[model samples]
Target: MATMCLLNICLVLLFSTEIYSLDCKMLHLQQNKVNMKSLELLSKMGGQFPLQCLNENRNVGFLQKVLRPTESQKENAKLIILEIFQQIFNIFSKNLTQAAWDRSFIQSFQNGLYQQIEQLEKCLHSERENEIPYLGNEKILFPLLKLKKYFERIGDFLKEKQYSLCAWETIRWEMERCLLFVDQLTERLQN
Candidate 1:
């Protein structure tokens, strides 16, 4: 019995130490603004956080392609914001794992992005003749402006080495706000 208990204790310690080591490495990489490839690798290695990937430099070509359908400058501005949201989603979804997913977390994240997408779609569909206005010019521009701050906060959290909890919270906050903004826009257009 004594030997068996000792073996279990040793295994637990070893696994915990391994997890801590991996988290430390992730913290280091996140702080450095490591490239996307490295971020992907760390995420694949069972890292639960997603702050590193979402904050990368925008892909100009991808943004242009995604926004090519819009003709009006105002609509195009909306598309630009949408494109950024999509990029953040792509990065975030790629990094998450089953263990990282909580129902509350996923629902909150999904709802936020869905809301933003809905808003943009509504504006595009409803404002057929009138200029929809650039997002920067919108009456409720505070939401998108808040999103920019979330991105910065995520970056700052990574910099501060709050790898495990802060990073996840940052991701959650960004997703929630973005979705809400989109949802508001969509609902407005439909009515």
Candidate 2:
């Protein structure tokens, strides 16, 4: 009887340890997935923004002439921002199954993102100065600024390790709002 009890206790301990380890691994994987999804969404914005700019067919020639001098700077900023996003995505992709949680890395990346947003904003503002009086610059700038805010919120949640469903839904809502503006702007530009 004593021997049987001892065996059962050992078995239970062994099984519990295995289960705990498995749970930890699963949690790590979930975290990685969330991070990767966020990065992918951010990267998509880079392409979407330029496409929106190009969709302004009527302003293409005039705006081009006005922006030609600083065009390279604008493009360079967008490319750099996109590259950074891709780099982060690649890192997350490579270690999808592992938990490479580094607070410093996330902080640095967030700061870089903010810097890029500022740079882009400045470029847009400069272009706005030469925009035709009737063209409402707010249509573009407002959505961009809103997207930046959403990114900041997402980054904060990521840094705090808060991946709640509600948080993600809120981010999604913000994204949709920005996209709606983009669609509206595209329509306006088309007309």
Candidate 3:
């Protein structure tokens, strides 16, 4: 009897995850407009990054390799996207206010990004705080590791530039690319 009850619980979880997944996919589809607005606001905030920073550098293309098309396990991709957003959110939290960049704009940008993060978190399950999610699966772990380095390199760049306006500007460009990929991944989530 207990085994049958356990099976029923598992089935319910499976169905709920699917329903949540559908909602998450739709959420991303709807988010494109909102994300474009945020990006436009960011551009208004700063775009005068230094010339050297604009030199088609190595780090700019790291994301393409890391966030490839969704494979058999769309959930893994979702988790990676979640991790990516969390990392960017942290970067913004730590450095955005340092330069006194337009107070209202900053608040609005953070709020929009925070809302998206919350929506994604609502639909996904993982013990993603300290440890990596899906640890044993090399396929899943690979992208997570690559993205970790990508965000870390962004940190390194910011530190090298003393987190100046130009540095934040470059980071803004990078963040835009990350969100675009997030959109792609969310669209590719299984129906």
Candidate 4:
């Protein structure tokens, strides 16, 4: 039942990346930890998700509409970016408890996600004496609210399946897409 409200900012400055040019690719280059390019690793060691996992909880194009590059998206880029990460954290964390998996698999993803989230958060806080403001403009707000519902649906779906291996498999599939989307967004992100 964990939710991803803004966590406390890690006061350390060196952990930050530029908000305008978040280099997720750089995250993968770390020699000793889980690579952020998880899709590459997963694909290399390929296995198909169960057939039951194939029927996805459709997002009604809300995710596309939000992430689609537009003037409005540009204006509210920071909030959109944060929202994406928040959703990722929420799903990934929920899966940690709801889905039983090998310890190494779950822990690695959790650690990688936390590191990425904290880096973004630290960057957002770099200019401010306090936390980043929780903005509420409709441009991002509506889509974010929509995305939130989609994520909640995912959580509900997980419970509905009694946290089956297939249920977790479906979630893992979704999360792979989510993380890949984040990586793509990181490439194009601008101030």
The segments of candidate 1 whose C-alpha lies over 4 angstroms from its true place after superposition are 1-77, 90-99, 102-150
Q: What is the C-alpha RMSD of each candidate to the true structure, in Å?
A: 18.1, 20.6, 12.1, 8.0
Question: How well is each residue in 54-97 modelled by candidate 2, as lDDT tens digits?
Answer: 33222111212222223223323232233333333333333212
lDDT for every model?
Answer: 0.41, 0.35, 0.65, 0.52
Q: List the residue pairs that clash in candidate 1.
A: 112-179, 113-179, 115-182, 115-183, 116-182, 116-183, 118-186, 119-185, 119-186
TM-score winner between candidates 2 and 4: 4
For residues 47-131, could you state the per-residue lDDT of candidate 4 as single tens digits?
5765665675543234554455552344354455566667766766664554445444444444445555665565556534574
In Å, residue 107's CA in model 1 sits off its true spot by 13
Lowest lDDT sum, 10 consecutive residues, model 1, at 27-36
Q: Can you write out model 1's per-residue Cα lDDT over 1-191, one digit (the tens) per residue?
A: 64564355345434543443343223222212212222233333334445564664322222222222222133234554565455465545543443354433343333334434444455445554466555555533543454455555555544454344445544544444443443333232222
Q: What is the alpha-carbon lDDT for the whole of candidate 1?
A: 0.41
Score candidate 1 by TM-score against the native. Answer: 0.32
Q: Which stretches of candidate 3 lie over 4 Å from their true place?
A: 1-25, 47-61, 70-73, 97-100, 126-133
Using lDDT as the measure, what is the rank order of every candidate, best first? Answer: 3, 4, 1, 2
Residue 71 of model 3 has an lDDT of: 42
The candidate, 1 or 2, that scores higher on lDDT is 1
lDDT tens digits by residue: candidate 3, 118-146? 66777564335555557788887878888
TM-score of 4: 0.64
The all-Cα superposition gives candidate 2 an RMSD in Å to the true structure of 20.6
